[model samples]
Target: MGNTESVVVQKRLTRFRPEERPVIEGVFDRLQGGAGGPSGAPGKTPAGKTLTLEMLQSSMGSLAPDSMVRRIYQCMCRIDPGMAAPAASGKTSTPTASGVGREQLVIFLADTMRGTAEERAPLVLAMSQHGAGAAAVVTCEQVAEFLQDLISAVVQILVHRGRLQAWKPEKMGDGSLGVKLLAEQMCSELKPSDQGACDVSCLEDWIFRVSQVSLYLEMLVAEGLNVSLSSRLAPTLLPPCRETPWKELRCLLDLPVLMFLAPQLPDSYNAPWRLVFSTQLHGESFTRVVTGLTNCGPTLLLIKDTKGHVFGGFASHAWEVKPQFQGDSRCFLFTVFPRLRVYTATGYNQHFMYLNHSQQTMPNGLGMGGQHGYFGLWLDSEFGRGHSRARPKCTTYGSPQLSGEEDFTLDSMEVWAVGKPPEPEEGEEGQGKRSVLHMDPEVQAIMEMTGKTLHSQGFREPEEDQE
Candidate 1:
């Protein structure tokens, strides 16, 4: 920034009173629900003059130049919550419901003003360059719109260097989608979020929304759950629905990455990441609710055992109950509450973890092991819970495995799907490749007794590649 501009920014920064300074680590700490603080008090930082540039950088978890800018942006939002374009003069619409209080500001910081320094610099510059006398009401959207126009050249750099190409299904061959994105379109595909129940009236409200989303993602990573967020790291897409289960466990929604799915979805397709999906539904009613769940895509399945312990799997594909096997490698079992432990696909011991119907015969149910089966976990067609037993196959996950020999019955089943399910246009690529092909266990047993190979209709082994 020029000398005049720097002086202007400093003056604006000092506008807020010392009493308003945060006592703790800014808004992020508060969102953590006081996870770490003196006396476990809510994260309200003390009002102080220490929010200088150096202090801001030190507070940043990421040291990138852009990350530093983001830190400054956070400080500005907190210290100058009043800085903004004014609410409209006409109809007094209610503020966005979710954005009504503190949480709204957090989301604005995390989403709208996020990305690299180049992405957020214009907003900072706009605020700094504005003459103090004018003090125009600067909405976050207005700043964003201004940046798009002024930085068209920067965006053009991407156009000259990159071009769109059709995506094919495969395991991420090391993040080689062969392209670099323009700044403007980086998060372009995520659906334009519903402005909650109402529209944001002023600037500070936008900042809070950004702040909230940023804190949530950072917390997710700090807790050690895997999430793909960086532009360079993380595959564009995991193996398709057939080859693998989950699309990709991305922490933040990125348009370039999401558009790689087969059926191209809308720019406003992002929603699942904004909220917590902890609702419970029953097995009997599950099928009915499954389609609607496509909006909140893949989900977590929790089964409460008769012993009062809860265990379940992550359904990599959307919940669709057909008379056959669906889903892929992304599906894995997990346990929440009494300590979190996730058991991923061993690839080797996959015979039992897959979903199937006709092959089992008798009662159409999930397949555990072939012919010599081990009913490690089972949920009946009824809405009630099923059974879980200890299993040798799940040993790699440590401790006593899920299923037991005594046929432990479960008490309840709860499911949670995140985001909207991939659209039919977005393409499920490898899912839904099989259907009811298993005969009754009795008839199959008799056929096996008479020396018959149990092959589901249309089941064919692929030919080996010729050298």
Candidate 2:
């Protein structure tokens, strides 16, 4: 770095507020004393004091594993070479021996939370490849392993520290699988070299393109260190969740998946996620599913195929069981199991959402994207039978087949009503109520088995005789 860049890096020392400065300095001082040091000791001199890997790990609590803390300590050393304590005569200095200085810690936190993409890219590379040279190249498998550790650490912090906002992990699907899937998705974004190795240049490109990489790193540091750097960290990374029925709510998505997908939804980051339907909680009845979906506002539909392929779509509007297509361009198809990816509309066609039942001429199934019989995702009204037929790709969403096979057997499904419901008309508050009467009789039968109540019907008013 040039002299100008060096000055900018040094200026990050003042990144914390006056009040928070003491907190940061206190952390530095505590860690500098090394493990087993006196807790009430006065602040140490920043110039000579250094923090070893053991010191860093001890200060990080149990949220992050030792390996993760090692990477972070290496990152601190790499951020400023001077931070690494010089090797004594006849002694080889290892990463643990090259302790982190106060200046390095300050710049690391500042660059992670508030620095430009250019400033954080190198730090990310260092964190991912500990003890490697600045120009070291990494393979996909190496990057994936690092991501897995990072994700695991973040999930532990969220669950152990009660940061899930009342979300119950017991009611959700396997979080370990979620961690592995999310790591693969994050690794897929890396631009590897011709030899499939990710050098510093590729890492920089990735950090520039995927903003979440920086976001995750910031969260890992802030939460793992138990530091209060609110002035620098962006709170909007995970917006405030609204109230919901905690006991009744169950979901296939874990907190990490939820955190990744929540920000992707358009203008719904602050909205509540209501459990509209779930095949596990509610029996396999297409009619009951449709009834639960009506007038619930924008929703997320998730399906787990028998082959363990988990995928779904985001409905930009409330679902209505009609022959014609519904939903706006904001609608998208996504995969959750094999990997996490969202395919938006390509504008080649308008076959965004399709939900029809009981019409002989039209298809008696629910579908999204593509056209007619060749929908990107289809769920037959008969239940358990579905298909993801995308010939090269769905013209609407540009997504390929999402299920394990072209046709698949549904193992489970979930529908979450995201955000607040759209305001109803003055006299149409119970509009979706009547639509329930028109639902298939089979749905009514299975609704009992699935525990779905027909209580909405009791509130309907008798229609007066028309003129």
Query: Candidate 1's residue-wise lDDT over 428-449, tens digit each?
Result: 4433432333324577678778
TM-score for each predicted model, relative to the true structure = 0.31, 0.83
Ten-residue stretch with the least lDDT total in model 1:
91-100
Residue 190 displacement in candidate 2 (angstroms): 1.4
lDDT at position 442, candidate 1: 75
The CA lDDT at 250 in model 1 is 20
Best by lDDT: 2
The stretch of ten residues in a row with the least summed lDDT in candidate 2 is: 83-92
CA RMSD of all predictions: 20.9, 6.5
Residue 426, model 1: lDDT of 35
